[model samples]
Target: MTIWTAIFLLLGGVGGGLLSSIASMASLASYPVLLAVGIPPVYANVTNDAALIWTSIGSTISSTKELKGHWKETWFFTIFTVLGSIMGCILLLSFPSSVFEKAVPFFITFSGIMILVSGKHNTLNTEKQPTWLRIVYLGTLLIMGAYTGYFGAAGGVIVLVILTYITNEKFIVINAIKNVISGFANLVALIIFMFTSHIYWLQAIPLAIGMFIGGYIGPAILRRVPEKPVRIFIATLAFVQSAYFFYTAYLR
Candidate 1:
């Protein structure tokens, strides 16, 4: 790889990791960088997925305080997420990318609205969760896993929003769980992608290194910032990203 390409990817990884940790929108940073560096869209997507495994590692380590008592739930959800990611990988390999590209903006916009609405309410914390609610949560994770494994633009935001409504925990804790689940789901997909010829290893390596550093820094920043502002910032970012994707997919 050229020195300039490596530098770009490393910088992209750092930015992607920070965003992924803060907003769960790692792809928004990394994917475009890949494209700008002249990687094909399909290869860039897979390469980005592979590199994101490092983000999970960094996030998991940094968020351990919040994750302390959540191990059982974490493992429980991970199984389903892994399954969903595998399915998503299969779909990506088998289907046309256009179908997902068309649907992404709507999904991102809906997820952002859900996060905003959920943040304003106390329903998730006050009410006793029923068995049905647990089932619903599981279902949401499965779907999110598949989505993250496939297209993955703002998949973390979607996961965070669902967790917000289902769990009574603080937003930071929910975000920590989101990181674990996202990491594992992507791990499954990365393993699958390892066998494929699509991953651009030259780009993926530098990106992974940068993301690892960013992931470690992300939770530290979260801990220092107030929760409300972080939520607002992430929600706004989601909406803006959604609009940009919409314009690119249809208007452009």
Candidate 2:
């Protein structure tokens, strides 16, 4: 609530936003920052999601150019994401915190393994994916989106991994659509969190402001950076963070 805290949260938001544009792990950064600033874990997670929601808006705008005539295709996944988010959050709420504690390590390790083994495979598209396989892809996303709504650290990465199988779009475009769908998923969860969970509004306000600016600048930076390295770096960071978070959650 102090001016100093406001300043820090704003800085965290910008950093978080930039990360989001690249990898969708903004929550991993800002959640800890909020906790370090004295917000409880529950409040920190909720507020971080609230702040990062703006990144989705910026990403959606940037992605619209790439999507061109593909909005219809995107909508089907978006609708599933929205519904899955609701279901996921409900599932999360149904469990005790201890359940999340036990599952965090498994979630993180699975994601890390997927990235390490499948990064090369990610380059392949769905030119040959059969109809049944497409259903599997959609189902995976829906299930993962639900997880994202519940405890989304690398939820965007989960979507990215799945999408790499279905389309040959540029990673940036895939990331942008992931943002929109995940944003919608989080939006629904945010509404529920506001009612059922504690939210650190004072922290979120500054973070949201910073994220707005960062999200706007991320794509331009991406254009200037080398693609393969950026993707590799992000994947590495996500894996490391997931490991750390899982470790911490397990110890709790």
Candidate 3:
């Protein structure tokens, strides 16, 4: 890649990482950049997964403070997430290029709406989480993890929502645990992708560096900004992207 292309990928990683810390959908920003830079769609997707693996390292460290004493709480969920991610990675590599090509826009649109509507509530207020609910959560995580392993734009957001429903934990703690475990899920999938896929190393290296920088910025910004406006802004952006995805996927 040229120096300019490298620079763009770097910035894309930074943006992707920062956005990831907040709500997940960050890949939406970087994937297009990869395509624009001449990476084929499948290669761009795989390379994005490769680069995004590191973005979680820093974010997970920061979230650990809030996750203290929460080991048992997270164990089962983590297992499901890891298993799901592995399944997803396998599915990803198995698919024809045309499959992912047709699926991408739909995935984006679905994930976007999920983040937007789910953002409205801060927590699940119901008394007991029914066994059925946990089943739904498990099934959802598995599918989402596979998708995340394949194309992780808003994986964190999905985790956050599921956790919110499962427990009465503080939002901060829930979010922190979400980061660490999701990191694990992505890490597992990323390693698998590294061996099996055509990772755009030239692109991934710079983007990973940018993600490291951006991860730091994201939490700091969230601390300073009030919650409502931030949610509004993020939700709005997600909605717009969702609309775009819908248009691109099924419409045209």
Candidate 4:
């Protein structure tokens, strides 16, 4: 790769990292950059996954303070996330991409609406959710895990929205968990991809470096922002992006 391409990817990674930390949409930044630099769509997606492992690492380290005391509660979901991720990887390798590609709009739209509605529910009501609600929540996470493992554009927003309903923790705290769990799910996929030839190490190296730096910087910015505004902003972005994806997938 040329030095200019490397520099462009590094900058993209940095932007992606910042957006990821704030809105969990790092792929929005890095994926397009990969395509612009001449990587094909499939390779770009896999290479993005490979490089994003570092975003998780960087975010996890930066969010250590927020993650404390939540590990016990998070462990159970983490297991399911790992399982879902593995399942997603199998599906990706074994099935036609169109199967999932067609579903992306619905997934994004549903997730965006959920986030918007969840904002209306009071987080302070500590009463245990009904059994059905619990089941639905777990199911959502499992599905989200699989999605993240397979094609994780805006996956973090979905995870963050579901987390808001299940836990009363501060948004930043929930976001921290979102980072770890999403990172974990992606990590499983990355490891699986590592054994394959799809990864472009040349592009991945600079992207990873950029994401690492961005991840670390993301939380610092998050701390300064008000929670409600950030949530609304992210949900709005998700909806807009969802529409764009739908247009490209169906109408275009």
lDDT against the true structure, each candidate: 0.87, 0.76, 0.72, 0.85
Candidate 3 lDDT over 1-252, as tens digits, reads 789988998898889888777666667677887888899987888787777766777676655666679878777678888988898787877775345545665555555455456657755764666788778877887777776776565567667767766777765566667766787887898788778878888888988888877765666666667655655666566666667755665788
Best by lDDT: 1
Candidate 3 weakest ten by summed lDDT: 96-105
Write out the backbone clash pairs for model 4.
Answer: none
Give one digit per residue, the lDDT tens place, for model 2 in 1-252.
889888888888788888887766787567778988988877777888888888887767766676677677677778878888888788878975456666766665566556545546545647676889999889888887788777676887777777666677776666667777888888998988888888878778888988887777777677678667766767777778767866677654
Error of 2 at 202 (Å): 2.2
**How much is 72 displaced in model 3, in angstroms?**
3.9
The C-alpha RMSD in Å for every predicted model, in order, reads 1.6, 2.1, 2.9, 1.6
lDDT of 2: 0.76
Regions of candidate 3 where Cα sits further than 4 Å from its true position: 97-127, 150-153
lDDT for model 4 comes to 0.85
Candidate 4 per-residue C-alpha lDDT over 1-252 given as tens digits, one digit per residue, 9 for 90 to 100: 889999999999998888787788888899999999999998899899888878878988999999999998778778878888888888888876677766788888888787777777674443677878877888889888888877776888988888888788888888888888888898899899888648889999999999999999988888998877887878777888788789888998
In Å, residue 117's CA in model 3 sits off its true spot by 5.4
In what order do the candidates fall by TM-score, top score first?
A: 1, 4, 2, 3
What clash pairs does model 2 have?
none
**Root mean square deviation (Cα) for candidate 4:** 1.6
